[model samples]
Target chain A: MYRQKYLFLLPGLLVLVAIILFPLLFTIRVSFSSWDVYNPGLNWIGGENYGRLWEDARYWQALGRLTLLSVTTVLIQYVLGFALALMVWRDLAARRLFRVLFLIPMMTTPVVMSVLWRTIFHESLGPLNPILESLGIGAAPWLSSAGWAFAAVVMVEVWQWTPFMFLLLLAGLLSLPNEPYLAAKIDGAGPVRTFFSVTFPMLGAISVGAILIRLIEASKIMETVYVLTSGGPGTSTETSSYYIYIRGMRDFQIGYSAALSLTYLIIMIVALTVIAKLLVRALVKDAA
Target chain B: MLKITDLELLVGSVAHLAAINASFQPGTLTTILGRTGAGKTTLMRAIAGLIAPDRGQILLDGTGWTRLPPWKRPVAMVTQQFINYPHLNVRDNVAFPLVRAGVAKADAAARAEAALARVGLAAMVDRRPSALSGGQQQRVAIARALVKKAPVLLLDEPFVNLDYNLREAFRKDLVDLLAVETGTVVLYASTDPREALQMGDQIVLLADGRIVQSGSPRDVFANPASLTAASVVNDPPINPIPFHQNGVADFGALGQQAITLPSGAYTLGLRASDIRAGGPHQARVTLTEVTGSETLTHLSLNGLDLVMQEKSVVLRSPGDVVGVHLDLHKGLVFGADGQRAGV
Candidate 1:
């Protein structure tokens, strides 16, 4: 029986080994070698690249920003998403229309949205600054100031990703049995009490799952930030992906770039493993 | 303590309903009887505050509840789907309302245990809903509703999905348990005639969203107000034989007899159990099903398929040429316009 089951899964196993396993192994091997674009030859550098990465201030700053972005984005998305889901759920009159409207931003291409936001925050002739100016308020440079630029990137990232969280959490909310809510209501529970006691506890699994998925996506987000800020304003908004791109493609330092990529990959693996363990715990508790 | 008056509801512009005014005396079990889509569920939902009527008034102890939201109505409902929280253990699911009411953890636990013990699920407190049998899950739902202590309980076909024996036991237990709560009013809905007759003290018969009749179960079942109510409130049905009034009901095969007519063309309604076999009336047996205890015999009698439920030792074979008899005094007669005739 086990053999038969394995036979059925042979195609998937082959695909995984070919696409994922092989590439990962190849990348790890390349990370340890000094094979720059100039010299199309590999010189075993051992732990030299690893040692350099530890002292790289730019890499550490980029890593820190990415961490901050991932944490802040996940937190914001979870709250905003859950709130939106609750609102949509309670307001049955416009639920379908609101769901479709919320999903529009998520469906739009990230690159395209980034371009649109770029125009809107263009320091002058942009919609936001002019609106502020019109309101008798001083207009601040949105993407030009380093501090403002980082904030803008975080805000835009949250906006594009909030809908993803909402859709996921909404599915969880909608799929929940309506009985608990009714029971709570019958017990004379006010709306707020019912939500905390019934809705939030029941949705823990879905909330964790949504956050983990958004966290993974946040760590890999590239196209939007690349197009919007280009990791400029003294690399204040620079993420790991942009830093890797700057080393490999712009500076032609493939060896250093490959080392950085490997480091990021390890960080991701550790983060995902921790998150997966927590998710499993949450799911098990829910199941129990 | 609950009264529903002048309730009218429309379902998404597709169906319209106008349920009759009904009241439940404290601690009384009022059974709502109807066919599918007869607005039984809609009426229950309206009372539970799950559905808003385009026009109506609901009163709990004479207080207007129509304007109150579901949370304020003090009503608990167990739907046909058996509403229990799947993620929570049986204990937590039962204690859900208590916990929400700000009962301390230990107190809530004690209450949950008591409710579970009442439902005979105390040993399975930690079990999830999926692990429980259909009947067990239903008990958990009941336990949860019981723990809520709502004065008005609206149950929509709570026993619809349970096996016959379990259904009977749970129905009995539920009626008995709810009976002890003097201030609570239970409105139970069912499409089953047997259940309605056995469990209902006061029965409301509905057809096409209108209350055809409302009275004691005995009265509604034995002397229904209309042909629809007669058919709906009896298992094996109070069989109706069409006949032109001619100032008498013509039971074609049983021979013509002068029967009193209230008004309009009338039909004779005979209870299947009241019918007897081996008479002069000639008819062919269309179907015969022996269900261990009794044999249900059907015949093509005067263009209507007449059913006779009898405790016969020997089951009659289908396609048998048989003679049937009717106890006319035991059956009702309905007028052509569907109203009860002669009473």
Candidate 2:
């Protein structure tokens, strides 16, 4: 019976091996050698690519920017999305309206949203700039200045994705059993205490899910940055994905790019594992 | 320490469907007995401040509670579902109110443990509700109420799901628990008359959003105000034989014999337990069913179905015509207006 079950899963297993497993192994193998695009044969240079990656200041800067963007965006989006979901969850009259309105941003293409944001942030007579100027504040270059460009990308990313977290957290909120809230009320707990103690702890799984999804999206934040800033004024808005795009695809250093991609994959795996462990630990302790 | 006066609750649709008028004194256990859709649960919810009564006043120790939300009402309600938080352990679920009340964590835990111990769930304190039995979960819900130590304890079928023994034990424990708490007023709702008989100090019988009868349990049982109240308070129900204005209560089939009453278009109510086979009247035995300790004898007499209890007597069988007697002194009489005949 167990053998038959394995046989039943054989086709899916084969597809997974063909599409994912084989390619991952091939990429790891290729990343170690100096296999050029033209030659297409492995010429082993061993640890040279790894050593070069360690010494690259541009790579370090990209990693730093990626970390900052992912961390800040994840935190901000989690807070804002959770708050909006809680508000919507509490109010029956506005729940459907706000759900539709908030989810509208998530349904739109991220690239399209980024382009719209870019137009809105245009330096000279954009809607926001004129409004700012009319309001007696000097219009600052939103996407032209290095710091402002990074900030602009972060804002666009948050706006496009906060609704994703909102949907998940709202589902989590709705799925929670109503007893704790009633128990809290009977205990003389005001709304604030009920939210922090009863509501937040119960929403732990959804929060973890939201953060994981946001982290992955934030790490691969290429399309929005590519459209809005195009790695901007300097490499200020350049994420690891953008860096990989420039080095591997644009420069066509296939083997070197594959090596860099593998390194990024390892980092992603490590971070996600650590985060999952920490989250499970905290949740278990809280449950205890 | 709770009093509800002229409590009228109208739930938006109609003027009369949700109206409840009653005044309950403090520290008394009142059981609101009703069938499904009779608005007993609605009345309790209104008093607990879960639903606002359209026209009434809820007072706690002479303080106005008309506008208070459930959180501000100083009342705790255990719903029929035994809705304890599944994510929380028994201790935390019990201690939930104290934690919310800004008590120190240690103090709250202590009180919660004591409450759990009171409900006989101390050994299962750290277990989640899913891990517990049905009776244990109900105990946890009661522990939540006890730990809250709220002045008014409202229970909507809290013991509905327990087995017979557990229900009996829990009912006794609940009575004792309520007795020890001086300021606590327990308002329990049950469809079962047996539960109301055992636990209620004051019994309010409801039907179609109106209180048909509200009095002490013994008074309600001994002299039910209406045929409906009588039926609701007994197992096989008080057999109501319809009669007419000639001072004759007609029980129509077995012989269509006229049972002369005191006066008017009155009905005679004979409880199944009060019906005996020894006296002068005769009834054809229609069926006899033995339910362990008691035998339920169904009979056809005076054109009505009369159910009576006999203690395993081997005197009758199906279709055996036998002479039976109803103890009229213990019978309740209801007049044409549906009120108790004497009242």
Candidate 3:
């Protein structure tokens, strides 16, 4: 009877295989083929695409650019999210109203928000440059220069997803026990000391969890780039996902794109694992 | 010395604590005895500067402490729950206050080690609080509170969460540790009357956010000012029987006592220990609880509920009929307004 009980899990297992397992297996097989727009058929060409990806300068550049963009944006979001969470977590004049207002950005769709941000970042006609000019800070370029386009992409990503970090951190702050804070207060710890000694240490596990979740979401950073910059200003903001999209959809190199996808999945898995370990070590003191 | 005058705290529209006036002497542990919501914690928090009273003056050593924040006050407190820094080791947990107060690092470590040794936790200084048992974690909290050596120390039911055996052991350890601090005016809050009677040098009985009685334990036990005071000072709680007969205190069906008193509505306070089994009056057992080696049985004679205490375990189920006898000569008499009249 116990042996037959495994059949009870068959439905969920079938759904997993249908949606996830089959695509993965098919992609692994297709990665070794020589399928393209011109050829239009799968022909065995083992390791050729992998060898080309290894020597592809543009692919390497996109990977590096993806790393820099994600790490910078995630760190900025973490800091700003923590600050906003602390602000609304405690006593405020209009706490409920502010909390709902803070959630507005995250509630909107990211691709839609990115499109709105594109209009906002328009060089002369947009409100941002005009305000900067009024404030005595002249606007040189937004989407017209390489560095400015990169910064514009980061700005949009930060604006769209920072509320996610804020929500998680706020939930974490709400769940923390109030007793440790009382102990800190009685021990004569000022605001800074209490934060370092009690609040930050208590928030360690949740902080790491939130950061890793954001990193995973951030590493796949192509939607905003697609809507806003579209790998603009000569490939300055072209991340790994957009490079793959260009190869598979735009250039129609299905075989090579499949190879890139599998390689990118493996790289993300290793990189995220490494980052999680480092975060756990750095944030949680007693875990060591 | 610490003194509070006319302290009033309002939560919503309810008065959590009102018209409070109390004084604590140095080298004495004043146990604030009350029920769970009797404002014992609010009073302690006001003294520690964790809570603000709407109208009050807290004078410490002839200087006002009302305006100072908790971080500025020279006070240390251990709450009912076990609160220790999970990220720090046991020694660092104890040393946190000292380090925060700007003591030398080595001096703070030494004092923390000494406090840990005093609490019988010398062998576990390097372990995190999460690695210890609940009792050990509370001990770390206690050691941390002790290492500060503040002039005023407030412990709000510090051992209320521990198991029975651990609570007893930690209580003894805490008393021993506190005995060494001669200058600290300790305010210990508890709902257990036995603990309040045993550990307090002076007892403050609170009811409905007011101090019903405050005196030495022996004095309060010998002469409870009111029915509320009598209830707070009793372990199993005192039973108040209505009596309104001339020259006799009628206890309705259970028995009556011929006493020299005027005819008026009064309450007769009877201790649980004075009521015994196997007597002329029969009562149905309503509840039975076996705690340690003693038994506390609740019996209802007619409509009056009376608790009987026995030295040894007596297993009696609910609805079981049993005979009980009350010692009327040892009872106390309270007036119609609940104030103790006389014996």
Q: B139-165, model 3: which lDDT tens digit per residue? A: 899899888989999999999998989
Instruction: Tell me the lDDT of model 3 at A165.
Output: 90
DockQ of 3: 0.63
Query: Number of backbone collisions per candidate, in order?
Result: 0, 6, 0
The global Cα lDDT (0 to 1) of model 1 is 0.82
Top candidate by DockQ: 3
User: Which portions of model 2 miss their true places by more than 4 Å?
Assistant: A1-10, A36-40, A283-288, B12-26, B245-263, B277-292, B295-303, B311-324
Looking at candidate 1 chain A, the ten consecutive residues that score lowest on lDDT are A279-288
Q: Per the 3 Å backbone cut-off, how many clashing residue pairs does candidate 3 have?
A: 0
Ranking by lDDT: 3, 1, 2
| lDDT of the structure predicted as candidate 3 | 0.90
Q: How is the predicted docking of candidate 3 categorized under the CAPRI scheme?
A: medium
What interface RMSD do all candidates show, one decimal each?
Answer: 2.4, 2.2, 1.1
The predicted structure with the larger DockQ, 2 or 3, is: 3
Q: Compose the digit string of candidate 2's lDDT tens values, residues A60-178.
A: 79989999999998889999999899889875696799889998888998888888999999998479889988899979889989999998988988898999999999999989888
Better of 1 and 3 by lDDT: 3
Residue pairs in collision within model 3: none
Query: Tens digit of lDDT per residue, candidate 1, span A207-261?
Result: 7788889989999878877988998787989999889889888887777788899
lDDT of each: 0.82, 0.81, 0.90
